[model samples]
Target: MSELARRYALALYSVCPDEQTLEQTAHVLMDDTTLWQTLCSPAIQGQEKARVLARLPVLDGHGLLLNFYRLLAEKGRMTLLPEILEAFNEEVLRQKGMARCRLSCVRAPDAAELDKLRRALCRLHHKQDVIFEIRTDPSLLGGFTLEIEGVRYDKSVRGALSGLGRQLEERRMA
Candidate 1:
């Protein structure tokens, strides 16, 4: 994350004392499908962004939150708002003893499989709260990769091939 994103996230998180409420607001901002679309719409004038944001009832309850949005609009930094929200949510989850886990698989896993994977990951990290992001990539061939923070567990066929190539190169050098 950039310094700008971190600063914005910290400012937004500071406005809501309750962690859950902060998380909820972050989720709303991240999940709102139309937010970026509206901001990018050419028909919408640049100066009108602040006005449009102010009329949103969801953001009106908290003055600090409202001000943050207006500031973002005024500065033309609204495009970074989603990233700011995501970073804020990550920080909140970290404070709550949670880790975000991303899984890339050849196909979508079933509910039971997802639950099992979640349990396994919890055991691996020794943390019960794990946020899972699942993505499908047919090119993976088989197996999946689990990325937690910066560490990655590569169990995919592509990874295995790369590992084998490295091993063969080392053997040739020997």
Candidate 2:
């Protein structure tokens, strides 16, 4: 993320630290490509952009966020909304003692299995909780590979086969 985006995120987060509000705002901004583009258009005057933002349905009850959007419009930084939202979300997760991880497996786990896996990973990593982004990779054949905090744990059949192949190659060469 750009330093500019981070700074904007920090400023907003400092004033109104409500995760739900920020998440809803992010969704509203992201779901409307036209609105995002319009706000970022240099041809549009700041006053027009601010008026457009002021009339948004999602921002109706979120005065602080509405004001923040208007500020961005006035400052010609509406192009950075995505990065600001990302940084804001990261800050929220960090403050909540939670972490995000990616899990790749042959199949997606059931709720019970996912909960168990989440708890296990939390224990292993000494985190309060973990949120997983799951993906099904048929190449794995079975089992899963988990990536968290820059560390990867490969427990898949493909990984096992690759490791065995490497060992065999090394022995043959030796």
Candidate 3:
């Protein structure tokens, strides 16, 4: 993220009350996949992108957030909306002392399993307020990986295989 983007995100994060609202706003901005596609389209010009962005109203935004979007659109910086939203979310999470845990599973875990995992994670992190955002990635083969903040617990089959491969290579060299 550029300094400008980070500044914008921080400004928004300061005003936004909760992650859900910020996430909703982000979803609205991201829902328009066509906008990004058009921006990347070879035939589109910068002026045209600005025009397109100008037409988009600030969804649920008041005061600062609204003004920021307008400024970005006016300056032809709309392409950075996703990045700004992501940065804003990170800032919000950090403020809440809630590290985001991204869990990718090969299949949807049962409710009981999810609860168990959540409890385990809460205990592991020693956090009274822990939040887990679960996702399913079939390509994981089996098991899953837990990403908390920047640290990763790679329990996925693919990760294990890669680790084993590395160990074998080291043994061969030694």
Candidate 4:
């Protein structure tokens, strides 16, 4: 959640040639265990870390991204990689006119059900598309809840019970 990380990520993303290049660089950084661990691990010496980062083969031919990695090491913000990547993804989604939605339910939805929900969300949000990040929680009781573009649609059985409880409480006071 570092503002600095968001700023740096935005700066890098703006200059990124395409989403593929940006994603590839992220994959390179994340795919190398030694390089990623060394840069983010505090157990390693700063200078040694720098040397290891400098030797990352994936960084070759990616000057801007390589410099970005070096700059983070210099500023001791290597741990911000995940945050920066998240921000960059959000930016990419925004640019593509897509929204990331969270769908929570008592059980996992089937593919057909998921597609149905996706289309409804797209129509509701008026966005080009909706990407669902689905999760299941038995505690939800039944039904599902959706969070899209900061607006939440709560339709779970648990939600209805909670509303009833609150209304009863207010009525008792009245």
Candidate 5:
């Protein structure tokens, strides 16, 4: 499924006229759950789905992509929208020479905090720019965990307690 999505994304990226349009189209697809469901619903026909997609003003200037989207719906591959969006985002970042980091915390960060985090991640990766995906997971218990480039850094309270427990167990055995 993901491979198919990647292929579609690459095809779109290849023909995409401008990065801004690609970004806007991707945002529309990513943010519209109802539209996604409608597109993927067996009840909706290709013409109906095409009409709905055409109504979106953001996609107005992107005729090629809009048609591509219609084609996916017609072929019943509309459910791959999410994966295709993901791949498209990755392609955009890759084109821009940036890396994305996933940061999960117990609560949302303020603008200043987020900026600081972005800077820190940029420095950590030695990259001029970094993209961040911030999410709140209350189960983290406090603090946050950062995942990037397949490496994970766990600083949550649960992680700390687990480390402490391991240290105590080692001492008891000694």
Candidate 6:
């Protein structure tokens, strides 16, 4: 995320400190393409965009968020909303003492297998909890790869084959 987005996220997260409101705001920003597009459009005047935001049901009880939308509109920074939301979510996870991991494999594991993996990852990383984002990648061939805190552990069949190929190429050159 850009520094600007992170700053905005930190400001919002600090003042609101409510996950449900932040989540609802994220949904409004992401799920409503028309609203998002209108907000981001240079053609729309700030007052018009404010009117649009004013009518949003999601912003009903969220005066701070409504003002935030106006500020973004006035500043013409609606384009930063997605990145801001991402950073905000990261802050939320940090506050909850949780870590996010990405698990890529050829197929998803069963419930028990997933639970075991979650426990193992938590113990390995010394985290209270881990939230997994699982992806099915057929090119992985068989095994899975785990990514945590920007570090990727590659145990996939495709990764092994590629490593072996590199070793063979190095021997040939030597």
- Candidate 5 per-residue lDDT, tens place, 2-83, comes to 7899899888889873657766775677578887778888898888988888898888877898898889988888788778
lDDT of candidate 2 over 13-118, digit per residue (tens): 8899997888887678767889878888999999999999888898888899999989999999888888998788877876888888889999999999999998
The residue ranges of model 2 lying beyond 4 angstroms of the native Cα positions read 1-7, 45-47, 74-76, 110-113, 158-174
Instruction: Give all candidates' CA lDDT scores.
Output: 0.77, 0.88, 0.71, 0.81, 0.82, 0.87
For model 3, name the residue pairs that clash.
Answer: none
Poorest 10 consecutive residues by lDDT, candidate 3: 58-67
State residue 29's C-alpha deviation in candidate 3, in Å: 5.4
Clash counts for the predictions, in order: 0, 0, 0, 0, 0, 0
Q: Residue 68 of model 4: what lDDT?
A: 77
**Top-TM-score candidate index:** 6
Q: What is the C-alpha lDDT profile of model 4 across 39-158, one tens digit per residue?
A: 777777677766766787766787887777777876677888888887788778878888899899999999999888888887877878888898998888999998976799999999
Name the best candidate (by lDDT). 2
Q: Residue by residue across 1-174, what tens digits does model 6's lDDT show?
A: 799998999999899878677777767776878878889999989888888888988889889999998899878898998888888888888788788999999999899988998898889878889899999999999999999866799999999999999999999999
**Candidate order (lDDT):** 2, 6, 5, 4, 1, 3
Instruction: Report the backbone clash tally of model 5.
Output: 0
TM-score of structure candidate 2: 0.70
TM-score of each: 0.69, 0.70, 0.67, 0.79, 0.64, 0.83
Instruction: Compose the digit string of candidate 3's lDDT tens values, residues 70-156.
Output: 566556676687788777777776776666688899987888997798778768776545567889998878999988756789889
Instruction: For model 1, name the residue pairs that clash.
Output: none
How many residue-pair clashes does candidate 4 contain?
A: 0
Error of 4 at 1 (Å): 5.2
Candidate 4, superposed: residue stretches over 4 Å from native: 1-4, 31-34, 42-48, 110-112, 172-174
